[model samples]
Target chain A: MKLLAITSCPNGIAHTYMAAESLRKAAEALGVEIKVETQGSIGVENEFTPEEIEQADGIIIAADKAVDKSRFTGKKLIVTGVQDGIHKAPELIKRFESGDVDAYQGDGKSINEVKQERKQKQNPFYRHLMNGVSYMIPFVAVGGLLIALSLAIGGHPTDSGLQIPKDSVWKQIMDVGSAGFTFMVPILAGFIAMSIADRPGLAPGMIGGYIAANGSFYGSEAGAGFLGGILAGFVAGYIAKWIKTWKVPSVIQPIMPILVIPLLASILVASLFIFIVGAPIASLMDWLTAFLNGMQGASSIILALILGAMISFDMGGPVNKVAFLFGASMIGQGNVHIMGAIAAAIAVPPLGMGLATLLNKRKYEKAEQEAGKAALAMGLVGITEGAIPFAAKDPLRVIPSIMAGSMVASTIAMLGNVGNNVPHGGPIVAVLGAISHPLMYFIGIIAGVIVTALVVNLFKKNVA
Target chain B: MKLTELMDKSLVDIDLNGSSKNEVLDEMIEKLDQSGALKSKRKFRKTIEKREKEGSTGIGFKVAIPHGKSKAVTSPKVAFGLSRTGVDWNSVDGEPARLVFMIAVPEESAGNEHLKILQMLSIKLMDEQFRTELLQVQTVDEAYELLDQIG
Candidate 1:
């Protein structure tokens, strides 16, 4: 009895394969003939055939994300989430074999339709939040890399620490990098609200985020930063969603979205920031800046240790972003050493994971080996988030290994006077001349990477 | 396509104690041979083994439908037997099969006739009422009557 299955997940990484493996094993154990297809971040694998479908007993779809099911029409089908596929595969197969499943009627709405419907039903606030995150990531990568590049090329040793020559081309490159940094908050808030309320939310979310990022409007020196942008996005999104849901006359419905929703939501969101959330957040940002600026000796090392842990912990998550912003602010203050340590710490996880995969191919799967290659390239450019997929899957082993390595690297950078003129890490930045004691900087990074690789390899059990 | 056309009272075995796959297959073949349904045991066994070599026919859920189309058959027929202890059929789910349905169709009508019988069985198998009754039947006539009702 031929059977077909599809497995997928939100992240399209570990859970996808895990569910696929479970279904395959369960089918084999149940004495059922079956073929499984997996849809992952890398795309489709082991696809099904029309002939197989025609001869099949039934089809099983286990996915969190969308999967096309129109092909299974006229065949007995069991539709469920990926977790069900993993845990209840045998039972699902039994139900199929027992002929209990209904014939699949192709509704023209495949798995993609189901996913779109689910997305539409999600809280508009969350939709906006993800939108902001998605748009913000590329900007962060570009800004961080350019600054790292300018520092490596134009930076010189100075009493103020590593300093870029005022009139140099590299200095202009640094300015361009900071220019990208400037849009980080506004773009984040704009896209988030756009995701929620469509075109209308864009204006309000961006304006609110801009106001939140600039301290002058809120009567505080330090801006609320990305945190404020997130707040603005949620505020704008919900206000827009509420307005969209409200009953209006047919004549005014179209106008409501075009004018009323945007106007009302934007005003509400912007006002809330100016009157309520903005002052406290600005003060907090200022206090954080002051605390970091005043730190010295052991106190500074303690701060560095905390920063290193946070940066390595989630591999570009909120904690990592906070640490990153701290280092970035230091770059603006013309104190490059703290940023230098941050840069080194940032590259440790991805570089370490990549090194670990290369050092022991047998320890990782085929897909993981491929990811390691990508991670290595991203690590060289100081994109710590490249390691997020690995860390998300096996955080128990990957996170601690990365944290230890980053902490050690940060400490070494502090001790050896490896200062960064730019707010980035990785050997490429150092090679470009962004760092002081470039040799020691390389040593620190290499040492951290080696330690992380070794530690992760030691802890990770062979999956196969 | 009628269930009675595929199921025979003489082909149904009431006593099956085999615990191994080979033993169960042999017992089923012996009953089919005794009923004069299969002409060559050796050829029919070879056909089933060959089909298994290509891929397991055990479609999961503790059910093994080992089928073959060969000249060994006197007519298209299906034999039913229950092995409570279960027999390893190298099934897709890797579970030992408890219910065995062996179909032996003539080679000439193998394609259409075998598929029709399979479709009929597949549809009825989904009915809990049919399966529960079939499982509880202690006599060959009772099984054949249930098959007859499916038509």
Candidate 2:
């Protein structure tokens, strides 16, 4: 029989994964097929698809914290504490064999649910926001790379900024990239709503995003941009979710998600954005652009420093996503220099740490030195997550070293007038000619890498 | 290369009377030495003791795997022993080891054959049913038959 399980604990760490491993081992011993999802400090991993849930004979939820059970309705489910999963996994799986467990009904309140309600109240925004950013990333990477490629191959410096000839193959590629770029805001808003209210929030969220992206809808140019899309997503999501709880007649209930919720939520989001949020956001965008354009030496350095620190601080966390998203939007607005500074900062951490391992072999273990080789390769491809192993092991030494390196790189790139039209950073973009002032960009990267290596080596004591 | 081929009636001690970790190791080594599996018993014993010092080979669940790969050995072999009264081997789980599998291999065969035996043994050892069945066997031949099923 196919079984699905979710394992979680209060700390979302050891107990959570331990339970998952134990359950997997038990299932293997019993020759039963089981898929387990773990919700830990890393967030949900190995999550079950809709098809997997539907085909499962039973569900096991072993968690101390509250898990959303609304999805497991109509399945044979056993809800218990995480310790049961760790020690009694075989017994828990055997419960299905005994045919003692009953199918889960929709509504229930237990001690776990009460604790869940308290914890769920804490970071609902973070969950929803991450849902959007997670979905938005692939669009950025694909569009950014294609645009960078087309510009490198077919672009020419012109009065109207970098332009491709009309009716050329490269123009088609760039157009495809632009098409992908156009969906970034809508998809981000749509998925955020989906995370909040499931399927019902999608239509209103996308419609609101479309309105937010188009300037004439709000009687202004620059139309509110991604910031507005985020606002619209949250507003539409909440409104649709509120509508879902209305206690409509049985006949109308079946059509509520398909018809009534979508129609009403879209209208509410559209009106709210156009009348209240849109114009102010557009003006703010314009004023911000004017302010950035007017910035010269020291002020611009400060901005780059902040952006650099944000990108490397969490290493692809919410703060990093914010800095990355800001740089991406700036490309569409024809301000590539800001993104150029960000790109220079993005690879500094991984490259610097990798160099540290090379320069000071005694300070790192043999396995860490091997990881350093992979880190160097990832750095070349502009993935900042390569520095994670180093940071996770010794955050005190690694974080400050990486931050300092990136900040210096960004400052140098900005001062040198290096501009990157694509959102991604590192040596790869500069190698592809996506970066202006390529010489200075390379120099900035090398300098940052050197500084990081030197700082980390200084902090790390020699091998005993 | 199979564990059963390396172990025989001469190498199997179904009921080990020893209650100490060193006593158990010495008994198992004596059996293997008499079978001509080791060229130098003193060197092989020293190597196994040195291996034990790095960390106890007692990997809990009442089982201990004490192995040595050294120039003192002329062949790769395994010796099995069962102690009714478990011996203290400083196991991670803080439980005495009741079942012990000691392995000796020449330094030349260490890289490949030694690892192959341990891997094959460990995969079977992970099964609680197999461990229980082996512990219940009445004679050396019965234990040999069970070890033959590993591959």
Instruction: Give a tens-digit lDDT track for model 2, residues A176-259.
Output: 977866776777788788889899999998888778766678776545555567777888899998887674544475578889
Query: What DockQ do the predictions score, one after another?
Result: 0.01, 0.01
Give, for candidate 2 chain B, the lowest lDDT window spanning 10 residues.
Answer: B108-117
Report the C-alpha lDDT of model 2 over B1-151, residue by residue, as the tens digit.
Answer: 5778677878888899788998999999999899888888899999989877866677566888788877777776888998887899997678899889987766642124344454567546756788898888889889888888855
lDDT of 1 by residue, A1-464 (tens): 67889988653433456567667777888888888888865457787756677788888999878887766767788889775775687888888877889988788665444444454344444445555766765565566557656755676644344468887999899889778767767888888788877777888888887877776777765466566676787678768867776645444654776688888988898789788976775666556555655664446678777777867975543456567777877777777778888878988887898999999988776767766776776688676755654663465678899999999888778777778876666776676667888777777888999999999999986743
lDDT of each: 0.72, 0.77
Residue A2, model 2: lDDT of 93
Q: Could you tell me which 10 consecutive residues in candidate 1 chain B have the lowest summed lDDT?
A: B108-117
Q: What clash count goes with each model?
A: 27, 0
Candidate 2 chain A: 10-residue stretch with minimal lDDT: A111-120
DockQ, Cα level, model 2: 0.01
- Give the per-residue lDDT of model 1 (tens digit) for B1-151: 5767666777777667787888888899887887777889999999877766755555456667777867777676788887766778887678888778887766542123334444457446544476678777787788788877754
